[model samples]
Target: MPRTLVIGAGVAGLATAALLAREGHEVTVLEKGTRTGGRAGVLERNGFQFDTGPSWYLMPSVFEHFYNLLGTTTQEQLTLVDLDPAYRVYSEPEPGSAAPHPVDLPRGADRVRQLFEELEPGSGPALDRYIASAKRTTDIAERRFLYNPFKRLNNLAVPEVLAAGPELARLLLTSLERYVERRFSHPVLRQILGYPAVFLGTRPQDAPAMYHLMSALDLDDGVRYPLGGFWEVLASFRRLAEEAGAQIITGAEVTEIVTAPARRRRLGRGPRRVATGVRWRDEHGVVHAEQADHVVSAADLHHTETALLGEADRSYPESWWEKVTSGPGAVLVMLGVRGELPELAHHSLFFTRDWTANFESIFGAHPSVPTPASSYVCRASASEPGLAPEDHENLFVLVPVPADVSLGHGGAEGQGDPAVEQVAQAAIEQIGQWAGIDDFEDRIVLRETIGPADFAGDYNSWRGSVLGQAHTLRQSAMFRPQNTSAKVSGLYYAGGTVAPGIGVPMCLISAELVLKHMRRDYSAGPLRTEPQRTARQSTGSRADGAGD
Candidate 1:
């Protein structure tokens, strides 16, 4: 069997290990963190459990399809429940209103259409047309784009792709904000359609209109949640990877990717090298080196390229990163409230009236953290009651800020740096005011905050970016970083930073792309062959290559 070493224990990392192990490879996964789940981790405090990342679980079909590839079913691994009112949108107070205006977006297509019609009379038809286009674009992306390895330009020029050439070009050329504003005059609706761009690590004005397909996932298909949390989902991935005959070692911090001493020179592209193994340090301050035929890094691409590999072996260097646009850093406030938050739903979005200025403050020429910032609140206990104590609620708040670590990291309340604490306090106040909660601050039994500096220290994130490179038109699709290293053979990348794009579904597709490219299969669709399944042995050890 081919010996393979997979770096990181993130969704993409575990998924890649599972896929490769199933293909008869002797796979071993190395994670820097003590536990599984990179960003989608869990924090337990006073009987309350908080999901530290990836609050919303969108795109059910993608999850289902990936499960099927593992010879399992989504229903078998997860108990998914669709959220009734998909979400509620809360906007900053209008001209004379004392409180913020709230719009409830219910589940189902017809109800969404009706809500649009009610918001802007005679908008039902326009919404229907827009939704149709969104659905078409989403379908096209799944069929001919998301799963593509981009190894062959011919694979992208298929009949279905050629048929939508004009439309595709138009969407690619336009901005998501421009596309939404052109169709909808309602500020709330436009914000609703455009805010998905934030999840892509770019403002709607910077993201290509092709991302409008995100609306189809939330509005048309409806929002759904796993009963437990994303941590549970990660556990499922770990289970699959272990069952597929892969070994996972936690607290193993990879220091360097060792390559052969000599590089073969190419005629014009300069010297090329081949990966030999990796040097890593375990938790107890011990160092060891392991050899493998192949290495796949699922850590932050910038960290993998700059920190792990040498300058000559890097595909994206420090200078290359300087030219790239980073996604917004964020201040994550996890609050364990004393009582139920009846006013807030499972998911709520707080949008500032001056939307453009808000985005500009973060991504423009001069960046500063915005006051009265637009934020997202996820009440996980609303869906999974077991997450909190009997009468309390769990609140996970996200505030987008510039990716500057100078703002500082996070800690327990009043313990973090001044800038980080100030932002967290402001977000709490904003949520209380906008959501119409009178005693919001008083009810906080527990509080924790994570800032850009925390992301940098914990994940070795570049620019302290919460997401990878922003999904600006210049940074997306073929323009984004490819999975393989140009300078080193047998080295590859799989994560939000590389192809297909960010989000859980995209990460899963990225893992598949690594397999596809490794096997030299570049078909622009999900793999169809039965995954080679070998006999399994579940093992995870802190010691190098040792099974427990």
Candidate 2:
């Protein structure tokens, strides 16, 4: 069996370790942080608990599938509470006017249908049809598109599939903005279509129309919150990994990789560099080296290439970093409120007047926060009441910013932590003005902000991007980073930056893709038999005698 080392202890890294361990590989996961969750870490302050990242869980089937792979189920470990009114969307009743206030749309198909009808007469039927079409897209993408690595376009060349043409093609090219515009005339409906792209890390106008199908998964399959907090989900992964015999080494930072040089005595191929081991630092600040046959990096692609890989084996032109690293980043503000705001739901989105202009401000360096910028507010206490003290709440707020250095916002070269706080306060002010929360600031018991610099320093993420590369057409599917390294043999990638795109589900898919590649390359690995445990003869004393 090949010895495998997985870098980063996030969901991607942990998932990879779990799968590899199950495959009978000696797997060790190295994490730089104090714990394994990475951005999905936890924070506790003044009797309040907050899940630093990934507040809401959608697509329960993905979690179910993950659990099933381990011969277990999430139901056995944690309770899954489906969020109602899935989220509230605050959009100006008019495009640019501040006159009409926000509306809280409930979750589920019928509720959404009623919402559409209330907004504009006769729009309900159109919405129903839109949802039907979206469901088809969701089915096709989940069943066919996401499972495979999408290594080549020819993978779709099956004859029967070709006969079922124009479906995926049409969905891929359709823009979400256009779909919403055509479905309902109400401005509220347009705002709802735009919400999905925020998590997708692109504007609706630029996001592929096929992604609107995500609404079916979001509104239909439903949004859920784990019982304790999202961190509880991470804890579940940790338990699964340990139970599967995977070793997780937190606070162990790997610095460099060493590869074996080619030897003329070799039989098969003459002189090829093979990875032999890696050098990492333990908690005591002592450096140590260990040998391993394979290395899977769940870290950022840029960090893996420039930092870990070093001069070992060059992958591509250094210029490739320029393109891959320039994805979206954001300014985040997390707060612990004094008392619960009964008006808020588990998830809420406050949209900007001009979504395109807001992006342009960040991407094109328009210099200020968008006049009516968008903000995402997640109320963790609503679902899991114990996260905070009695009657208190935990708010995880985020405002997406440009990754551009020229924008001169909250980062290393700019105004620093104070700037992040100012911006967050401004966001809270706007949220208050729109949502009618008069005591917004006073409710803040404790608040902290993380900007571009924090992203780079804490997680080593490219330009502080919470999500990896932008999901532009040029960066989607096969065009995205390959799971297996093209230049460095025995090296693989699995995370938000890879195929099937971003989010928790996509990250899980990435881990599966890496395992598939490993299984193909290393034939000596465990056989895919019962998948629970391998049967082997034991070397204990014979049944008749015990050294008598």
Identify the candidate with maximal TM-score: 1
Error of 2 at 254 (Å): 1.3
Which clashing pairs does model 2 show? 174-209
lDDT of 2 by residue, 304-371 (tens): 87787755464644567776534567777777777768767788888766777887765563445565
Please report how far candidate 1 places residue 53 from its true position, in Å: 0.5
Off by over 4 Å in 1: 261-271, 529-548
The model with the greatest lDDT is 1
lDDT of 1 by residue, 282-337 (tens): 99979999999999999999999999999889888888888999999999999999
Q: How many Å off is the CA of 315 in candidate 2?
A: 2.5
TM-score of 1: 0.95
lDDT at residue 51 of model 1 (Cα atoms): 94
User: Cα lDDT of all candidates, in order?
Assistant: 0.88, 0.72
Each prediction's TM-score versus the true structure: 0.95, 0.88
